[model samples]
Target: MSRSRRRPGRCRNPNWFGQMAVQLDLGLHRLGFGMEELDHLISDPQWCAEMVPDLMLAHLPSGNDRLSQRNVADRDRFLKMTAQLSGFRKSVAASSGIFLGAEFHFDVVRPGSALFGINPMRGSANPMLPVVTLESRIIQRRHLKAGTRFGYDRSFTAEQDMLVGIVSFGAMDGVLFSPRPGQKISVFLDTHTAPVIGSGGSDTLFVDLSDVPDRACREGQIVSLINHQHDLETCAFEHGITEYELLARLGSRLPRKTCPIVLPPCIGKQGAINTRDQTSR
Candidate 1:
């Protein structure tokens, strides 16, 4: 049977490789071979002289002391065992295994988070495409009196009369509430950029919107979640969870208008494509 441990669930749309495995199994069944007999066919040298197992997927656990305790010795043992048992045409290192160097990268590497530019291994330079961008609209703008307390827990008490922009996006919308001191964040306004200061606990994110020079950012102005410079993995580490869990926890109630830049056509009506070919036409 063809299976993948990487995506452990029922199949909705099987790929080309999955379909081929189904066809092969049907052929074997027609030849009077049971399921166990078919399993033996690949390993038995005399059963099929020409046939050989073509691919093997290896999942190497990351050696993080806090997260997991899998080490190099465990990986080496698995690889050696596989090599001795069968002729592996291609072997893939899954997930965090991509950071394990050339030895782990037998032929291919299956990395899900690394594909989205999230570096699980701290200090390693990430080279991958960022996949998510968050944006919110300003709900209201107001001036808070000096010493005025705000939010549910009175997290921030204004030291001075400060202009604050209340955004529709909040902790519920996947915008993290907690931020480290001096952490940089941005807000997009009418093709101009505004710097926002994140200050407060991790649950209730508070941004100092007093620095916005433009008066037009009064209300209904959109702010982008800049993923380019912001490290989501680091944020998740601070929050005590995997990056995958953080993404999955994002509430669906928040009106998400997909950025046409990377989302597929089916997600939304295709936006105007800007290219030389279209410009010339």
Candidate 2:
């Protein structure tokens, strides 16, 4: 209701008409009209007639306390108030709300994080398919002798002769330079995982490739930084940060490509070829 001053004028203009929505602050405090303001807003005949809302939405920002006594009570109050509006479609649920039973679900539901394969409910196993894969190409390989110090500040000293692969990913690309205490960060290729060695450079990180097959450790080989086994949530946890922060910190310089959608057999050969051709191009 912060846009109350402009709504009346905009709604009154015949040419400016569009689908309108009202947000009620159930408890989020981020946006929306307070419970007291809702009564005042609906009571004004001029305002109601002019601003015809098509949708009524109330978002629950915190999923952790969703089922708490206070939240349930607030949700009930919101439902009671909005039930009177016969014409308006309602949406009160998000990703976490899906598990809270059907009552929270109205005419529509908005699953923001879930759409991006992020877990809607914290501390629960994720049920969404991973849609993102972060990878980097191997740039170089090094053979270090026993007692050889590696990386910035010589954080790692080789215990024996080993092969190390330098990857294109680094701290600038949302990867940590050094693992946190009691944690080990790694990248994968096929079934083998290579632990990161020492600190990272601006655009490069060293991985202990001795355990990986020689063929897989070759130059220009692809290494999975974030994958199904090492998902965003898992990687973020090892980095001592949230999944959101890890995603947001991804370097702008990194190239992004969407995975081709697999169509069912019913779509025919032409459709499959078209998708492949587009992806290839």
Candidate 3:
């Protein structure tokens, strides 16, 4: 039986067992075997003899609450308990565990968000540059009178006469967003920003374009949903989702373009990659 608790719902299949990578539940409760569970596996002579451990993995929780004493103690306990294991050549810290300290980083590090320019260390100035930009093309434009309702369930009513543009991107395109009470969500048109004003439609989004200049409000004009100013972190924050979820939820139907990275001053003429999602017009 696989002792790692990474996937609780996954059925344990004995047929596939050849070797094992021991997962230690350091702080993140979602995966790995607990200390008591580890002890059981270690003491079981028949199981120990059959299975060989390839490596130990301990994932430390990230964000503001990661530095708790209990987590540190758990890690200390894990180290002490795993010291006797002979075969596993390395200890690896996954994801944000790399930032916890050098001790957490043993032989390897598995970085996720940091690779895509998300700040692994939150609450600090982001050291990574923007790597993705998601744009939606305006497919149509309309003028609304005050009291006119817009989108599904009539979620928004025009407060005053305003110009609005419908973009070819919405909930179906992984833009699952809703404004909080008294809050506004926006998309950028060059230097101007237009507020999203209604329930997310399946394949279209309504943006109030009254603030954007007439020249920039033309049909087929690209409006940025994710840019340097409104990066993945910001968009995810506004959507009340994680950066990983936002990235993962992006619909596969959208067109993708990969271009050489010439932007961001720090790179300075170096070769890098940037991806753009062109969500139709």
Candidate 4:
């Protein structure tokens, strides 16, 4: 992944080692970093003889087509290599690798992003559940003429008689600046879609609500900032940002709504004050 020198903090995928609960089998990337880690752990003959890997959890080189000839050759090499190691139950294809099909899924398969509605198949249709849905209330609505300028340095201007809502999300909320002159990123309000106008302040960005009905477009109505139409993938691409980065940066500052499931209560750890009591300190 290419990175910029200026802002070194871009969102990226998590580097998970391995977990048992998901039955993901064992895997590694960067040629599966764990493979080296395991080699280190089991280097001693005593430890090496005792340690038996259940599977070779493998990682594919990024930006390669899953079904490409190169990937096929690489997979063949990985499987052949694993053959030298006895007693493993099966092989496992990591999240994206599952899209490659039965060959990649020997005994187990791990599906991470697929659980959260991300498209497991690159450049293909998404077939997973969308676990997240974001919403924010409109703080203000303004009507402007064609010449009226808006935002930082008046970067955007009204094209005609228009209405816009100052949404409660901006730089402070981790919203990136517009990537170019005419890219279209948007938010959904009920059944209607509204295009983003521009950023106005550290705490807000504008959305074109001209086509929305007055009652629905008024200030204080909550609007969906993300949905199927302006899905995470589409928005990330539109903004010249990485999907990993875009997903990571958003909603960090937003308040969490009440969850559907009630979590069990927790007692303070010996003498530790509850969050409610700490504020008085």
Candidate 5:
């Protein structure tokens, strides 16, 4: 890995010895540095033994600036170091690093977000299967008077007298308050689709009753959190948090149901079907 000029206030110079261990396997014989200063460090046999690691794992730091220009700096440095070193068979790039394009796709790509159907970077196409669903139960429905205060702190005052449904989900369940009065979120109810409007709160999700007037969803009705056409990162940004935190913050009270996905039989393997019948039969 190419070393950067150590950031201000940092005592030790930034070195690539640790990063080199991760890209290459246990058998590392040589070490390269950014310039003569790093080269001198590697020259010390005792220092080389201590710094030269057998195996290493390079991961992007969490929190903000994770997928920004600094990510590019780290990725480029690692790529450069790997290229300079010989006999390195495999290299792996993490989620944001893959966005550097196919040039960064070495032997393998470790994609945690894409595997869960989340596009980490904005404006990029995601090619992974979605694996999460959110559902909420309705608790109550009431008709509100015009200018009635809703929720704690009297955040929302009704525009006019309207019916509202109290849902089980809230900010505790990852629902965030919207700046606008009525932000519509698409939800699936069995075979039917409907909209759930956002009401200001950190612990309650509200739905406008006027939007879906046909079917009456009473207490104990289950609604799915719609994820098909929306981006998770966009949702996180809307919620004023990082994508990783948004996923991590999903409340544990929500019950999860898992089902196995089966693929079609392999065509040419041992248990595969043979199309050529006459001679084989």
Candidate 6:
């Protein structure tokens, strides 16, 4: 289970580890295990540690003074229990808990969002490599006249005649981002960028390409929407979506495949390579 307490429903109550079980709750600041089933398993001398869950310290938010004190007290109690079990095997830490300190590190760790360059330590330096890079291909490029009104309910009105590129991404693609007031946002086009001038549509994204080179703005060109320079994080933060949710929201038509590195033919006619990132061995 996850060590960070956020979205309690996601990281809690997983029933798949084993019948030889261990359990934890992030909100409970739990590390040691003695769940109903786990206690029964541990009582049997024949049961091995490997059959249980990967034990790790998880954080629950400090809600109030009473809760804070209780969490600390409970953590101390669990620490003592964990110490007794320590020599038997090292436990594992979750994505965000790796930075909690060496005391939390067992032998193994589950790299969740951390595997995708999300800062394990929220305010600290990110130590992971870039995992997913999102891009969209251009399908058409054309000129927009001044006073042009477009999009659903005519949400966009051109201030001047401008050239725009119709990229192969849209609301259905999970790229419809709502910018904060007066924010300057753009997309990566070759060595430069093109500004997004309006709300993203359902099947196509509109980018201002009036000043860009004609060749670079041509059809079939791939433009990066998410990149390594903290772009993924920025997008998630600004759009008020969890990192995992943002990634999951992307369209299914784009290239994505799970793997053990089997390079089979692409999916259908529009298939793209799935670049699932793994921590270096």
Q: Highest TM-score among the candidates is held by which one?
A: 2
The TM-scores, one per candidate, come to: 0.56, 0.82, 0.76, 0.68, 0.59, 0.68
- Please write out the lDDT profile of model 4 over residues 10-29, one tens digit for every residue: 21225633421111213323
User: What stretches of model 4 exceed 4 Å from their correct place?
Assistant: 1-43, 62-64, 89-91, 129-131, 159-161, 177-179, 255-281
* Candidate 3 lDDT for residue 19: 55
Please list all clashing residue pairs in model 5, or write none if there are none: none
Writing each residue's lDDT as its tens digit, candidate 1 over 1-281 gives: 53322112343333523321111221213322233434454455542343334554444444322134454655555454454435544343544565555565665556666555565464555534466655667777778898998875676688888877766656656645454565555556655555454343333334567666656576777766445444556546656677677777678866555554564464443333432122221
lDDT of 3 by residue, 104-171 (tens): 66666676677677776656666567888898799999999999997888888999999999988877
The best-first sequence of candidates by TM-score reads: 2, 3, 4, 6, 5, 1
**Per-residue lDDT tens digits of candidate 5, residues 138-232?**
77787899988877677667888877777777776665635343344555556555555545465566776655553656667776653544446
* Top lDDT prediction, candidate number: 2
Of the two candidates 5 and 6, the one with more favorable lDDT, higher being better, is: 6
Q: Go through the candidates in order and give each one's C-alpha lDDT.
A: 0.52, 0.77, 0.74, 0.61, 0.54, 0.60
* Candidate 2 per-residue C-alpha lDDT over 1-281 given as tens digits, one digit per residue, 9 for 90 to 100: 44544456655776775788998888778788776677777777888777878998887665544446665776687788797566988877776666555677777777766656688666666756676789988999999999999788888899999998999887777666467777798899888999987888888988999889998789999999888888888888888887777788888889988787454567788976763342221
| Model 3 steric clash pairs | none
Instruction: Pick the winner on lDDT between candidates 1 and 4.
Output: 4
Winner by TM-score between candidate 2 and candidate 1: 2
Q: Pick the winner on lDDT between candidates 4 and 5.
A: 4
Question: Which ranges in model 3 have alpha carbons more than 4 Å from their true place?
Answer: 1-20, 44-50, 62-67, 145-147, 153-155, 159-161, 255-263, 267-281
Clashing pairs in 1: 177-205, 178-202
TM-score of 6: 0.68
Task: List candidate 1 stretches off by more than 4 Å.
Answer: 1-55, 63-72, 84-90, 99-103, 129-131, 153-155, 174-176, 179-206, 237-245, 254-281
TM-score of structure candidate 4: 0.68
Worst 10 residues of 4 by lDDT: 2-11
